[model samples]
Target: MRTAAVIGTGLIGTSVALALTRRGVTVYLDDADTTAAATAEAMGAGSMAAPESPVELAVLAVPPAHIGSVLARVQGRGLAHAYTDVASVKARPHHEIQSAGADPAGYIGGHPLAGGERSGPLAASADLFEGRLWVLTPSAHTERLVLNRALELVSLCSGVPVIMDTVAHDRAVALTSHAPHLIATIMAARLENAADESVRVSGQGLRDVIRIAAGDPSLWRDILDANADAVADVLDTYAADLGGAVTALRALGSADETRRKQAGADLDDLLRRGNRGMHAWCGNRARRPPVFCRCP
Candidate 1:
Protein backbone atom coordinates (compact mmCIF):
# COMPACT_ATOMS: atom_id res chain seq x y z
CA MET A 1 0.00 0.00 0.00
CA ARG A 2 1.09 3.57 -0.58
CA THR A 3 0.28 4.91 2.87
CA ALA A 4 -1.17 3.74 6.18
CA ALA A 5 -2.09 5.10 9.59
CA VAL A 6 -1.23 3.45 12.87
CA ILE A 7 -3.30 4.30 15.94
CA GLY A 8 -1.77 3.70 19.37
CA THR A 9 1.97 4.09 19.61
CA GLY A 10 2.67 1.04 21.76
CA LEU A 11 5.12 -1.73 21.03
CA ILE A 12 3.07 -3.55 18.41
CA GLY A 13 1.87 -0.34 16.79
CA THR A 14 5.32 1.23 16.61
CA SER A 15 6.84 -1.98 15.31
CA VAL A 16 4.23 -2.24 12.55
CA ALA A 17 4.78 1.35 11.53
CA LEU A 18 8.53 0.82 11.41
CA ALA A 19 8.14 -2.28 9.23
CA LEU A 20 5.82 -0.50 6.81
CA THR A 21 8.06 2.56 6.63
CA ARG A 22 11.06 0.32 5.93
CA ARG A 23 9.12 -1.06 2.95
CA GLY A 24 8.66 2.51 1.60
CA VAL A 25 5.01 2.84 2.69
CA THR A 26 4.34 6.26 4.16
CA VAL A 27 2.87 5.75 7.66
CA TYR A 28 1.04 8.28 9.85
CA LEU A 29 0.79 7.79 13.59
CA ASP A 30 -1.91 8.83 16.08
CA ASP A 31 -2.24 8.09 19.75
CA ALA A 32 -3.99 9.66 22.73
CA ASP A 33 -0.61 10.57 24.06
CA THR A 34 0.69 12.87 21.36
CA THR A 35 4.19 12.82 22.84
CA ALA A 36 4.33 9.06 22.55
CA ALA A 37 3.27 9.26 18.93
CA ALA A 38 5.93 11.92 18.31
CA THR A 39 8.51 9.72 20.01
CA ALA A 40 7.63 6.83 17.71
CA GLU A 41 7.91 9.16 14.73
CA ALA A 42 11.31 10.38 15.92
CA MET A 43 12.37 6.74 16.13
CA GLY A 44 11.56 6.50 12.38
CA ALA A 45 8.39 4.48 12.87
CA GLY A 46 5.92 6.90 11.22
CA SER A 47 4.54 10.43 11.21
CA MET A 48 3.33 12.08 14.40
CA ALA A 49 -0.28 12.57 13.33
CA ALA A 50 -2.95 11.13 11.05
CA PRO A 51 -2.65 11.82 7.33
CA GLU A 52 -4.79 14.63 5.91
CA SER A 53 -6.52 12.26 3.48
CA PRO A 54 -7.76 8.74 3.95
CA VAL A 55 -4.90 6.24 4.14
CA GLU A 56 -4.88 2.92 2.29
CA LEU A 57 -5.03 1.04 5.56
CA ALA A 58 -5.19 1.83 9.26
CA VAL A 59 -3.85 -0.45 11.96
CA LEU A 60 -5.56 0.02 15.32
CA ALA A 61 -2.91 -1.14 17.77
CA VAL A 62 -4.82 -0.25 20.90
CA PRO A 63 -5.71 -2.40 23.88
CA PRO A 64 -8.56 -4.89 23.42
CA ALA A 65 -10.92 -2.72 25.47
CA HIS A 66 -10.54 0.36 23.24
CA ILE A 67 -10.35 -1.15 19.75
CA GLY A 68 -14.06 -1.04 18.94
CA SER A 69 -14.63 2.60 19.81
CA VAL A 70 -11.37 3.80 18.28
CA LEU A 71 -12.08 1.88 15.08
CA ALA A 72 -15.54 3.35 14.82
CA ARG A 73 -14.28 6.90 15.37
CA VAL A 74 -11.41 6.61 12.86
CA GLN A 75 -13.48 4.93 10.15
CA GLY A 76 -16.34 7.35 10.69
CA ARG A 77 -13.95 10.26 10.31
CA GLY A 78 -12.71 8.84 6.99
CA LEU A 79 -9.23 8.45 8.36
CA ALA A 80 -8.63 5.25 6.44
CA HIS A 81 -10.04 3.43 3.43
CA ALA A 82 -9.91 0.13 5.30
CA TYR A 83 -8.95 -0.80 8.84
CA THR A 84 -7.78 -3.69 11.02
CA ASP A 85 -6.92 -4.16 14.67
CA VAL A 86 -4.19 -5.94 16.62
CA ALA A 87 -6.22 -6.83 19.67
CA SER A 88 -5.61 -10.21 21.30
CA VAL A 89 -9.33 -11.01 21.55
CA LYS A 90 -11.43 -10.75 18.39
CA ALA A 91 -15.01 -11.77 19.24
CA ARG A 92 -15.72 -8.91 21.61
CA PRO A 93 -14.62 -6.19 19.19
CA HIS A 94 -16.39 -7.93 16.29
CA HIS A 95 -19.66 -7.95 18.21
CA GLU A 96 -19.10 -4.41 19.46
CA ILE A 97 -18.61 -3.04 15.97
CA GLN A 98 -21.68 -4.83 14.63
CA SER A 99 -23.81 -3.74 17.54
CA ALA A 100 -22.70 -0.12 17.16
CA GLY A 101 -23.82 -0.20 13.50
CA ALA A 102 -20.31 0.55 12.26
CA ASP A 103 -19.30 -0.53 8.74
CA PRO A 104 -17.85 -3.97 9.28
CA ALA A 105 -17.46 -4.32 5.54
CA GLY A 106 -14.23 -2.32 5.44
CA TYR A 107 -12.85 -3.74 8.66
CA ILE A 108 -11.11 -7.00 9.54
CA GLY A 109 -9.92 -8.47 12.82
CA GLY A 110 -6.24 -9.35 13.21
CA HIS A 111 -4.11 -10.74 16.04
CA PRO A 112 -0.37 -11.34 15.83
CA LEU A 113 0.81 -14.14 18.05
CA ALA A 114 4.18 -12.49 18.69
CA GLY A 115 5.43 -10.32 21.53
CA GLY A 116 8.11 -9.98 24.14
CA GLU A 117 7.85 -9.98 27.94
CA ARG A 118 8.03 -6.17 27.81
CA SER A 119 5.63 -3.45 26.66
CA GLY A 120 5.65 0.15 25.30
CA PRO A 121 7.28 1.80 22.28
CA LEU A 122 10.84 1.46 23.62
CA ALA A 123 10.53 -2.31 23.43
CA ALA A 124 9.23 -2.22 19.86
CA SER A 125 11.13 -4.12 17.16
CA ALA A 126 10.51 -3.96 13.42
CA ASP A 127 10.99 -7.72 13.20
CA LEU A 128 8.65 -8.55 16.09
CA PHE A 129 6.09 -10.37 13.92
CA GLU A 130 8.54 -12.21 11.72
CA GLY A 131 7.85 -15.97 11.53
CA ARG A 132 4.89 -15.61 13.88
CA LEU A 133 1.27 -16.59 13.29
CA TRP A 134 -1.15 -13.79 12.45
CA VAL A 135 -4.82 -14.70 12.73
CA LEU A 136 -7.49 -12.98 10.63
CA THR A 137 -11.19 -13.25 11.41
CA PRO A 138 -13.48 -11.96 8.72
CA SER A 139 -17.24 -11.85 8.79
CA ALA A 140 -19.51 -12.72 5.85
CA HIS A 141 -20.04 -9.00 5.22
CA THR A 142 -16.30 -8.36 5.00
CA GLU A 143 -15.11 -7.24 1.59
CA ARG A 144 -12.84 -9.50 -0.43
CA LEU A 145 -10.44 -6.66 -1.15
CA VAL A 146 -10.21 -5.88 2.53
CA LEU A 147 -9.50 -9.52 3.33
CA ASN A 148 -6.77 -9.64 0.67
CA ARG A 149 -5.28 -6.41 1.99
CA ALA A 150 -5.19 -7.85 5.49
CA LEU A 151 -3.51 -10.98 4.18
CA GLU A 152 -0.98 -8.82 2.34
CA LEU A 153 -0.25 -6.94 5.55
CA VAL A 154 0.39 -10.23 7.33
CA SER A 155 2.72 -11.31 4.56
CA LEU A 156 4.50 -7.97 4.62
CA CYS A 157 5.19 -8.50 8.28
CA SER A 158 6.59 -11.97 7.47
CA GLY A 159 3.83 -13.65 9.45
CA VAL A 160 1.94 -16.84 8.65
CA PRO A 161 -1.74 -16.25 8.10
CA VAL A 162 -4.57 -18.33 9.57
CA ILE A 163 -8.25 -17.66 9.04
CA MET A 164 -10.97 -18.54 11.55
CA ASP A 165 -14.32 -17.28 12.76
CA THR A 166 -14.24 -14.88 15.69
CA VAL A 167 -15.64 -17.37 18.17
CA ALA A 168 -13.27 -20.09 17.04
CA HIS A 169 -10.32 -17.72 17.32
CA ASP A 170 -11.30 -16.71 20.83
CA ARG A 171 -11.72 -20.31 21.93
CA ALA A 172 -8.41 -21.40 20.43
CA VAL A 173 -6.51 -18.55 22.06
CA ALA A 174 -8.24 -19.22 25.38
CA LEU A 175 -6.97 -22.77 25.39
CA THR A 176 -3.49 -22.21 24.02
CA SER A 177 -2.61 -18.81 25.46
CA HIS A 178 -4.98 -17.40 28.07
CA ALA A 179 -5.26 -20.56 30.15
CA PRO A 180 -1.53 -21.17 30.15
CA HIS A 181 -0.92 -17.57 31.22
CA LEU A 182 -3.28 -17.96 34.16
CA ILE A 183 -1.74 -21.28 35.13
CA ALA A 184 1.65 -19.64 35.17
CA THR A 185 0.36 -16.82 37.33
CA ILE A 186 -1.12 -19.30 39.77
CA MET A 187 2.20 -21.11 40.09
CA ALA A 188 4.14 -17.89 40.62
CA ALA A 189 1.69 -16.50 43.15
CA ARG A 190 2.86 -19.11 45.64
CA LEU A 191 6.33 -17.58 45.61
CA GLU A 192 5.37 -13.99 46.21
CA ASN A 193 6.52 -13.85 49.81
CA ALA A 194 8.88 -16.78 49.58
CA ALA A 195 11.90 -16.66 51.87
CA ASP A 196 15.42 -16.19 50.51
CA GLU A 197 16.22 -19.83 51.08
CA SER A 198 13.13 -20.96 49.21
CA VAL A 199 13.66 -18.61 46.23
CA ARG A 200 17.34 -19.43 46.12
CA VAL A 201 16.45 -23.08 45.52
CA SER A 202 14.38 -22.16 42.41
CA GLY A 203 15.64 -23.83 39.23
CA GLN A 204 14.89 -23.87 35.52
CA GLY A 205 11.75 -26.00 35.88
CA LEU A 206 10.00 -23.53 38.18
CA ARG A 207 11.38 -20.60 36.21
CA ASP A 208 10.04 -22.04 32.97
CA VAL A 209 6.61 -22.69 34.43
CA ILE A 210 6.33 -19.16 35.80
CA ARG A 211 8.09 -17.14 33.14
CA ILE A 212 4.88 -15.74 31.64
CA ALA A 213 3.79 -14.72 35.11
CA ALA A 214 5.76 -11.53 34.48
CA GLY A 215 3.14 -10.46 31.92
CA ASP A 216 0.90 -7.52 32.73
CA PRO A 217 -1.94 -8.76 34.89
CA SER A 218 -4.36 -6.04 33.78
CA LEU A 219 -3.94 -6.94 30.14
CA TRP A 220 -4.30 -10.66 30.82
CA ARG A 221 -7.37 -10.05 33.01
CA ASP A 222 -9.11 -8.29 30.12
CA ILE A 223 -8.16 -11.10 27.73
CA LEU A 224 -9.34 -13.82 30.14
CA ASP A 225 -12.58 -11.98 30.72
CA ALA A 226 -13.26 -11.65 27.01
CA ASN A 227 -13.07 -15.44 26.55
CA ALA A 228 -14.10 -16.55 30.02
CA ASP A 229 -16.14 -19.60 29.06
CA ALA A 230 -13.44 -21.16 26.90
CA VAL A 231 -10.75 -20.39 29.48
CA ALA A 232 -12.97 -21.90 32.16
CA ASP A 233 -13.26 -25.10 30.16
CA VAL A 234 -9.47 -25.43 29.97
CA LEU A 235 -9.15 -24.73 33.69
CA ASP A 236 -11.80 -27.33 34.47
CA THR A 237 -9.87 -29.99 32.58
CA TYR A 238 -6.67 -29.01 34.37
CA ALA A 239 -8.47 -29.19 37.70
CA ALA A 240 -9.61 -32.73 36.92
CA ASP A 241 -6.05 -33.81 36.12
CA LEU A 242 -4.75 -32.16 39.30
CA GLY A 243 -7.42 -33.97 41.33
CA GLY A 244 -6.36 -37.34 39.88
CA ALA A 245 -2.74 -36.62 40.73
CA VAL A 246 -3.66 -35.74 44.30
CA THR A 247 -5.68 -38.93 44.72
CA ALA A 248 -2.85 -41.05 43.35
CA LEU A 249 -0.27 -39.40 45.61
CA ARG A 250 -2.50 -39.87 48.67
CA ALA A 251 -2.96 -43.52 47.73
CA LEU A 252 0.82 -43.99 47.96
CA GLY A 253 0.53 -43.83 51.77
CA SER A 254 -2.06 -46.62 51.96
CA ALA A 255 -1.53 -49.50 54.40
CA ASP A 256 -1.67 -52.25 51.75
CA GLU A 257 1.67 -52.69 49.91
CA THR A 258 -0.05 -54.09 46.79
CA ARG A 259 -2.47 -51.13 46.64
CA ARG A 260 0.42 -48.70 47.14
CA LYS A 261 2.44 -50.38 44.39
CA GLN A 262 -0.58 -50.19 42.07
CA ALA A 263 -0.94 -46.50 42.84
CA GLY A 264 2.78 -45.97 42.11
CA ALA A 265 2.36 -47.80 38.82
CA ASP A 266 -0.63 -45.65 37.95
CA LEU A 267 1.41 -42.52 38.69
CA ASP A 268 4.27 -43.79 36.57
CA ASP A 269 1.89 -44.52 33.70
CA LEU A 270 0.41 -41.03 33.99
CA LEU A 271 3.88 -39.44 33.94
CA ARG A 272 4.83 -41.51 30.87
CA ARG A 273 1.64 -40.47 29.13
CA GLY A 274 2.45 -36.83 29.89
CA ASN A 275 5.91 -37.23 28.38
CA ARG A 276 4.54 -38.92 25.28
CA GLY A 277 1.87 -36.27 24.85
CA MET A 278 4.42 -33.46 25.15
CA HIS A 279 6.67 -35.15 22.59
CA ALA A 280 3.78 -35.54 20.19
CA TRP A 281 2.83 -31.92 20.65
CA CYS A 282 6.38 -30.86 19.90
CA GLY A 283 6.54 -33.27 16.92
CA ASN A 284 9.52 -34.98 18.54
CA ARG A 285 10.52 -38.50 17.60
CA ALA A 286 12.19 -40.40 20.43
CA ARG A 287 12.54 -37.14 22.41
CA ARG A 288 14.95 -35.66 19.89
CA PRO A 289 15.13 -31.91 19.37
CA PRO A 290 13.02 -30.50 16.55
CA VAL A 291 15.08 -30.11 13.40
CA PHE A 292 15.21 -26.32 12.93
CA CYS A 293 17.18 -26.42 9.66
CA ARG A 294 17.48 -28.93 6.82
CA CYS A 295 20.57 -29.47 4.69
CA PRO A 296 20.40 -28.48 1.08
Candidate 2:
Protein backbone atom coordinates (compact mmCIF):
# COMPACT_ATOMS: atom_id res chain seq x y z
CA MET A 1 0.00 0.00 0.00
CA ARG A 2 1.24 3.54 -0.71
CA THR A 3 -0.05 5.04 2.54
CA ALA A 4 -1.32 3.47 5.79
CA ALA A 5 -2.41 4.61 9.22
CA VAL A 6 -1.56 2.75 12.45
CA ILE A 7 -4.09 3.77 15.08
CA GLY A 8 -2.30 2.45 18.14
CA THR A 9 1.39 3.33 18.44
CA GLY A 10 2.14 0.55 20.93
CA LEU A 11 4.48 -2.37 20.31
CA ILE A 12 2.62 -4.23 17.56
CA GLY A 13 1.34 -1.04 15.95
CA THR A 14 4.72 0.68 16.02
CA SER A 15 6.48 -2.46 14.88
CA VAL A 16 4.01 -2.74 11.97
CA ALA A 17 4.55 0.95 11.25
CA LEU A 18 8.32 0.45 11.26
CA ALA A 19 8.03 -2.48 8.84
CA LEU A 20 5.73 -0.55 6.49
CA THR A 21 7.96 2.50 6.63
CA ARG A 22 10.99 0.38 5.80
CA ARG A 23 9.08 -0.80 2.72
CA GLY A 24 8.54 2.88 1.65
CA VAL A 25 4.89 3.03 2.77
CA THR A 26 3.86 6.40 4.15
CA VAL A 27 2.67 5.50 7.66
CA TYR A 28 0.65 7.86 9.83
CA LEU A 29 0.71 6.97 13.54
CA ASP A 30 -1.87 7.76 16.22
CA ASP A 31 -2.53 6.60 19.82
CA ALA A 32 -4.52 7.51 22.89
CA ASP A 33 -1.19 7.96 24.60
CA THR A 34 0.34 10.91 22.79
CA THR A 35 3.77 10.02 24.11
CA ALA A 36 3.49 6.62 22.45
CA ALA A 37 2.68 8.18 19.09
CA ALA A 38 5.52 10.67 19.48
CA THR A 39 7.91 7.92 20.50
CA ALA A 40 6.97 5.91 17.42
CA GLU A 41 7.26 8.96 15.21
CA ALA A 42 10.63 9.93 16.72
CA MET A 43 11.84 6.39 16.15
CA GLY A 44 10.78 6.89 12.48
CA ALA A 45 7.86 4.50 12.51
CA GLY A 46 5.44 7.06 11.12
CA SER A 47 4.20 10.66 11.07
CA MET A 48 2.05 11.59 14.08
CA ALA A 49 0.00 14.17 12.16
CA ALA A 50 -3.43 12.99 11.09
CA PRO A 51 -3.69 11.81 7.52
CA GLU A 52 -5.07 14.52 5.16
CA SER A 53 -7.07 11.83 3.37
CA PRO A 54 -8.02 8.18 3.66
CA VAL A 55 -5.08 5.84 3.33
CA GLU A 56 -4.99 2.46 1.64
CA LEU A 57 -5.16 0.63 4.98
CA ALA A 58 -5.24 1.19 8.74
CA VAL A 59 -3.88 -1.14 11.42
CA LEU A 60 -5.74 -1.04 14.70
CA ALA A 61 -3.31 -2.12 17.40
CA VAL A 62 -5.53 -1.35 20.33
CA PRO A 63 -6.62 -3.75 23.11
CA PRO A 64 -9.20 -6.42 22.32
CA ALA A 65 -11.94 -4.79 24.41
CA HIS A 66 -11.52 -1.46 22.66
CA ILE A 67 -11.65 -2.94 19.14
CA GLY A 68 -15.40 -2.52 18.50
CA SER A 69 -15.71 1.10 19.63
CA VAL A 70 -12.42 2.15 18.09
CA LEU A 71 -13.40 0.44 14.85
CA ALA A 72 -16.76 2.16 14.91
CA ARG A 73 -15.18 5.55 15.47
CA VAL A 74 -12.62 5.07 12.70
CA GLN A 75 -15.10 3.62 10.17
CA GLY A 76 -17.40 6.54 10.95
CA ARG A 77 -14.70 8.91 9.75
CA GLY A 78 -13.80 6.87 6.62
CA LEU A 79 -10.37 6.19 8.15
CA ALA A 80 -9.09 3.85 5.47
CA HIS A 81 -10.11 1.92 2.42
CA ALA A 82 -9.59 -1.29 4.37
CA TYR A 83 -8.78 -1.96 8.04
CA THR A 84 -7.31 -4.77 10.15
CA ASP A 85 -6.37 -5.14 13.80
CA VAL A 86 -3.41 -6.73 15.59
CA ALA A 87 -5.26 -7.60 18.75
CA SER A 88 -4.82 -11.21 19.96
CA VAL A 89 -8.52 -11.95 20.59
CA LYS A 90 -10.75 -12.19 17.52
CA ALA A 91 -14.22 -13.45 18.53
CA ARG A 92 -14.79 -10.76 21.17
CA PRO A 93 -13.94 -7.88 18.89
CA HIS A 94 -15.71 -9.44 15.95
CA HIS A 95 -18.95 -9.63 17.88
CA GLU A 96 -18.47 -6.19 19.36
CA ILE A 97 -17.98 -4.57 15.98
CA GLN A 98 -21.04 -6.38 14.66
CA SER A 99 -23.06 -5.26 17.68
CA ALA A 100 -21.85 -1.71 17.18
CA GLY A 101 -23.34 -1.86 13.68
CA ALA A 102 -19.99 -1.08 12.09
CA ASP A 103 -19.48 -2.05 8.48
CA PRO A 104 -17.58 -5.33 8.21
CA ALA A 105 -17.03 -5.01 4.47
CA GLY A 106 -13.75 -3.18 4.96
CA TYR A 107 -12.62 -4.80 8.20
CA ILE A 108 -10.81 -8.06 8.95
CA GLY A 109 -9.51 -9.33 12.29
CA GLY A 110 -5.79 -10.09 12.42
CA HIS A 111 -3.13 -11.16 14.87
CA PRO A 112 0.55 -11.42 14.10
CA LEU A 113 1.92 -14.34 16.17
CA ALA A 114 4.96 -12.43 17.41
CA GLY A 115 5.87 -10.10 20.27
CA GLY A 116 8.23 -9.69 23.22
CA GLU A 117 7.90 -9.56 27.00
CA ARG A 118 8.49 -5.83 26.76
CA SER A 119 5.81 -3.43 25.40
CA GLY A 120 5.28 0.08 23.99
CA PRO A 121 6.85 1.76 20.98
CA LEU A 122 10.28 1.69 22.60
CA ALA A 123 10.19 -2.12 22.58
CA ALA A 124 8.98 -2.24 18.98
CA SER A 125 11.12 -3.53 16.12
CA ALA A 126 10.66 -3.51 12.36
CA ASP A 127 11.42 -7.23 12.15
CA LEU A 128 9.17 -8.26 15.02
CA PHE A 129 6.85 -10.22 12.70
CA GLU A 130 9.56 -11.56 10.39
CA GLY A 131 8.88 -15.20 9.48
CA ARG A 132 6.06 -15.45 12.01
CA LEU A 133 2.49 -16.63 11.47
CA TRP A 134 0.06 -13.75 10.91
CA VAL A 135 -3.54 -14.88 11.30
CA LEU A 136 -6.32 -13.39 9.17
CA THR A 137 -9.88 -13.94 10.44
CA PRO A 138 -12.29 -12.58 7.88
CA SER A 139 -15.97 -12.45 8.76
CA ALA A 140 -18.55 -13.82 6.34
CA HIS A 141 -19.40 -10.25 5.48
CA THR A 142 -15.76 -9.25 4.91
CA GLU A 143 -15.10 -8.02 1.39
CA ARG A 144 -12.58 -9.68 -0.89
CA LEU A 145 -10.72 -6.36 -1.13
CA VAL A 146 -10.39 -6.21 2.65
CA LEU A 147 -8.90 -9.71 2.81
CA ASN A 148 -6.51 -8.89 -0.02
CA ARG A 149 -5.40 -5.68 1.67
CA ALA A 150 -4.69 -7.61 4.90
CA LEU A 151 -2.73 -10.26 3.02
CA GLU A 152 -0.71 -7.48 1.40
CA LEU A 153 0.01 -6.08 4.84
CA VAL A 154 1.31 -9.46 5.96
CA SER A 155 3.44 -9.80 2.85
CA LEU A 156 4.89 -6.33 3.36
CA CYS A 157 5.76 -7.22 6.96
CA SER A 158 7.47 -10.44 5.77
CA GLY A 159 5.02 -12.61 7.69
CA VAL A 160 3.24 -15.77 6.60
CA PRO A 161 -0.51 -15.44 6.29
CA VAL A 162 -2.82 -18.17 7.63
CA ILE A 163 -6.58 -17.82 7.26
CA MET A 164 -8.67 -19.19 10.14
CA ASP A 165 -12.21 -18.90 11.48
CA THR A 166 -12.56 -16.56 14.45
CA VAL A 167 -13.63 -19.24 16.98
CA ALA A 168 -10.91 -21.63 15.92
CA HIS A 169 -8.37 -18.82 16.04
CA ASP A 170 -9.36 -17.99 19.60
CA ARG A 171 -9.12 -21.61 20.73
CA ALA A 172 -5.79 -22.12 19.01
CA VAL A 173 -4.20 -19.10 20.63
CA ALA A 174 -5.64 -20.07 24.01
CA LEU A 175 -3.76 -23.36 23.82
CA THR A 176 -0.57 -22.13 22.19
CA SER A 177 -0.16 -18.60 23.57
CA HIS A 178 -2.53 -17.59 26.36
CA ALA A 179 -2.25 -20.67 28.60
CA PRO A 180 1.54 -20.71 28.39
CA HIS A 181 1.77 -17.16 29.66
CA LEU A 182 -0.41 -17.92 32.66
CA ILE A 183 1.59 -21.10 33.34
CA ALA A 184 4.79 -19.08 33.34
CA THR A 185 3.26 -16.45 35.57
CA ILE A 186 2.09 -19.11 38.02
CA MET A 187 5.52 -20.75 38.07
CA ALA A 188 7.27 -17.41 38.53
CA ALA A 189 4.96 -16.30 41.30
CA ARG A 190 6.36 -19.08 43.45
CA LEU A 191 9.72 -17.33 43.28
CA GLU A 192 8.27 -14.27 44.98
CA ASN A 193 8.20 -15.94 48.41
CA ALA A 194 10.89 -18.46 47.58
CA ALA A 195 13.85 -18.66 49.87
CA ASP A 196 16.95 -17.00 48.44
CA GLU A 197 18.77 -20.31 48.63
CA SER A 198 16.17 -21.89 46.36
CA VAL A 199 16.23 -18.98 43.92
CA ARG A 200 20.04 -18.79 44.05
CA VAL A 201 20.27 -22.25 42.55
CA SER A 202 18.14 -21.22 39.57
CA GLY A 203 19.17 -22.41 36.14
CA GLN A 204 18.47 -21.57 32.50
CA GLY A 205 15.40 -23.84 32.53
CA LEU A 206 13.78 -21.75 35.25
CA ARG A 207 14.59 -18.50 33.47
CA ASP A 208 13.31 -19.79 30.16
CA VAL A 209 10.09 -21.01 31.68
CA ILE A 210 9.41 -17.74 33.47
CA ARG A 211 10.77 -15.32 30.88
CA ILE A 212 7.30 -14.58 29.38
CA ALA A 213 5.95 -14.18 32.89
CA ALA A 214 7.76 -10.85 32.98
CA GLY A 215 5.37 -9.37 30.40
CA ASP A 216 3.21 -6.32 31.19
CA PRO A 217 0.58 -7.61 33.63
CA SER A 218 -2.09 -5.01 32.86
CA LEU A 219 -1.94 -5.85 29.19
CA TRP A 220 -1.94 -9.55 29.97
CA ARG A 221 -4.91 -9.06 32.24
CA ASP A 222 -6.91 -7.62 29.39
CA ILE A 223 -5.77 -10.31 26.96
CA LEU A 224 -6.55 -13.11 29.36
CA ASP A 225 -9.88 -11.57 30.20
CA ALA A 226 -10.79 -11.11 26.56
CA ASN A 227 -10.27 -14.83 25.87
CA ALA A 228 -11.22 -16.14 29.29
CA ASP A 229 -13.51 -19.01 28.23
CA ALA A 230 -11.02 -20.51 25.83
CA VAL A 231 -8.15 -19.89 28.21
CA ALA A 232 -10.16 -21.44 31.03
CA ASP A 233 -10.72 -24.57 28.98
CA VAL A 234 -6.99 -24.87 28.39
CA LEU A 235 -6.26 -24.19 32.04
CA ASP A 236 -8.75 -26.84 33.08
CA THR A 237 -6.78 -29.50 31.23
CA TYR A 238 -3.52 -28.20 32.66
CA ALA A 239 -5.02 -28.16 36.12
CA ALA A 240 -5.84 -31.86 35.77
CA ASP A 241 -2.29 -32.55 34.63
CA LEU A 242 -0.92 -30.51 37.50
CA GLY A 243 -3.03 -32.47 39.96
CA GLY A 244 -1.75 -35.70 38.47
CA ALA A 245 1.85 -34.55 38.75
CA VAL A 246 1.36 -33.57 42.39
CA THR A 247 -0.20 -36.90 43.24
CA ALA A 248 2.67 -38.70 41.55
CA LEU A 249 5.29 -36.64 43.40
CA ARG A 250 3.65 -37.34 46.72
CA ALA A 251 3.27 -41.02 45.83
CA LEU A 252 7.04 -41.24 45.43
CA GLY A 253 7.25 -40.99 49.25
CA SER A 254 4.72 -43.80 49.87
CA ALA A 255 5.59 -46.78 52.06
CA ASP A 256 4.13 -49.13 49.46
CA GLU A 257 6.75 -50.14 46.91
CA THR A 258 4.12 -50.46 44.12
CA ARG A 259 2.86 -46.94 44.76
CA ARG A 260 6.42 -45.55 44.54
CA LYS A 261 7.07 -47.47 41.32
CA GLN A 262 3.77 -46.24 39.81
CA ALA A 263 4.71 -42.67 40.74
CA GLY A 264 8.03 -43.06 38.91
CA ALA A 265 6.20 -44.23 35.79
CA ASP A 266 3.77 -41.32 36.01
CA LEU A 267 6.59 -38.77 36.26
CA ASP A 268 8.36 -40.40 33.34
CA ASP A 269 5.17 -40.27 31.28
CA LEU A 270 4.65 -36.57 31.91
CA LEU A 271 8.25 -35.69 31.10
CA ARG A 272 8.17 -37.78 27.93
CA ARG A 273 4.91 -36.18 26.82
CA GLY A 274 6.44 -32.72 27.29
CA ASN A 275 9.51 -33.76 25.30
CA ARG A 276 7.34 -35.04 22.43
CA GLY A 277 5.27 -31.86 22.41
CA MET A 278 8.42 -29.72 22.20
CA HIS A 279 9.71 -31.84 19.35
CA ALA A 280 6.47 -31.37 17.41
CA TRP A 281 6.61 -27.61 18.03
CA CYS A 282 10.16 -27.49 16.68
CA GLY A 283 9.31 -29.69 13.73
CA ASN A 284 6.49 -27.40 12.61
CA ARG A 285 8.70 -24.31 12.68
CA ALA A 286 10.98 -25.72 9.96
CA ARG A 287 8.03 -26.10 7.59
CA ARG A 288 6.78 -22.87 6.04
CA PRO A 289 3.29 -22.54 4.59
CA PRO A 290 2.79 -21.43 0.98
CA VAL A 291 3.06 -17.66 0.60
CA PHE A 292 0.04 -15.66 -0.56
CA CYS A 293 0.56 -12.98 -3.18
CA ARG A 294 0.01 -9.27 -2.72
CA CYS A 295 -3.15 -7.65 -4.02
CA PRO A 296 -3.14 -6.30 -7.59
lDDT of each: 0.86, 0.93
Q: How many clashing pairs per prediction, in order?
A: 0, 0
Q: What are the per-residue Cα lDDT tens digits for candidate 1 across 138-249?
A: 9998999889889888887888898989999988888779998999999899998989899999787898889898987777777887888999999999998888889889
Q: Estimate the overall C-alpha local distance difference test score of candidate 2.
A: 0.93
Residue 28 in model 2: shift from native, Å? 0.9
Question: What are the runs in model 2 whose C-alpha is more than 4 Å off?
Answer: 287-296
How many Å off is the CA of 86 in candidate 1?
1.1
Q: Write the per-residue lDDT of candidate 2 for residues 1-296, one digit (tens) a residue.
A: 89999999988999999999999999999999999999999999989888999999999999898989999999999889999999899999999998987888889999999995989899999999998899999999999999999999999999999999999999999999999999999999999998999999989879989999999998899999989999999999999999999999999999999999999999999998987776666657735323331212
Overall local distance difference test of candidate 1: 0.86
**Ten-residue region with minimum lDDT total, candidate 1:** 287-296
lDDT of 2 at 241: 95
